[model samples]
Target: MTSLETLLRNTQDVKVIDRSIDYNEYIPLDLSAFNPELSKFDIKCAVSFEEFIEKHLTLNDAKVAFGGYNEQRNLYQRSTVFKDEKTEERNIHIGLDLWIKARTPVLSALDGKVHSFNFNAGFGDYGPTIILEHQLENQIFYTLYGHLSLDSLKDLEIGTVFKKGEQFATLGNAAVNGDYSPHLHFQIIKNIAEKFGDYPGVCSKKELPFYLENCPDPNLLLKITA
Candidate 1:
């Protein structure tokens, strides 16, 4: 039997963003200053998340800013969701973030039915989020699309089905999308447990191992070159 990882790796000819955008159009953004060797920038100075993303896109000369899989980032400093007295700081990002303009079409990575969705509104929350359930071969899994426009969730139902590459959601602005840049936070889960419209896209150092196991790298299926 083919393993879930291998199966995802074998999936061909698919995209979560506009099909016309080429790999070259995707810019690898390193928001994390975890690596001392890597050059760092102050994104906090930007007036808004929209300005921050636009500035990076202009600097890189690309339409899309993509990255943040297992990357330790300082971007979570603004939200208490990642840091509270009870738990250690959750600074490691486990999902792929595609930074782009608001209202940019977001497509399904695969054929799946909407399992659950909710407006996770907060300073650093997912905002309008959707989780899709899918079964490949004999295995079951889920894909989450976070930081989506509220309009995307207006008409969606729990069992609504979306074909592969079907545009189901649009990117949300900073006001609604966790007060950050407009980006699609995509994550894959082997088992979602009882979580509904929300899951931990970022984890603390102690929880990293478990999350890493449950939520594999989304690039395994996206094949988006850095």
Candidate 2:
């Protein structure tokens, strides 16, 4: 069987957000701990973070800001979902994030059927999440779309078919999307195990190896090089 990475690399013209916006309009964004600019503002505030994203897009003359796969971010420190007294903090982001305004159309990366859907409501959670199962090159894998609008799941059902690039959801706002800036958290899972609509999008240093192996970089499928 072909490796999932190779299969993804071989795939072409895959876009998971706003099909109307070309790749040229997408700019790489750095929300990682290494970015000094993030410390200047209150990262915990959703409205402030949205303003930061808007400024980033405008400054770069771009429409979309994308990145965060395997990035260690301080932004997660604000949520108990990532840390507590006993467990180490899961600061490393394991998915690609596309920063855009709320209501931006979210597309399916490939032809697949809805495997699960749920409203994972909580601070720093992936509210209104959806997972799709697909068979590619004789391999079964899953793609997770997080932080989606509630209306996106209003009438959605398991086994609903969505073709490549088809609009299946819309980005959710801070109010419904874990109180973070509006963006789509896109991840590719090799083995979903018993996980349903929800999956870990962040991991601690000790858990990195396992999560990294299970969740490959989403850019492999998106092919967003800029």
Expressed as tens digits, the lDDT of each residue in 100-214 for candidate 2 is 9999999999999999999999999999999999988888999999999999999999999999999999999999999999999999999998998999999999999999999
Best by TM-score: 2
Q: Ten consecutive residues with minimal summed lDDT in candidate 1?
A: 37-46
TM-score of each: 0.93, 0.98
| Local accuracy of candidate 1 as per-residue lDDT tens digits, 59-124 | 888999999999998778768989999889999999999988889999999999999999999888
For every candidate in turn, the CA RMSD to the true structure comes to 2.1, 0.9
lDDT accuracy of residue 165 in candidate 1: 95
Q: In model 1, which runs have C-alpha deviations exceeding 4 angstroms?
A: 35-48
Clashes counted in candidate 2 amount to: 0
List ranges where model 2 is wrong by over 4 Å.
Answer: none
Poorest 10 consecutive residues by lDDT, candidate 2: 217-226
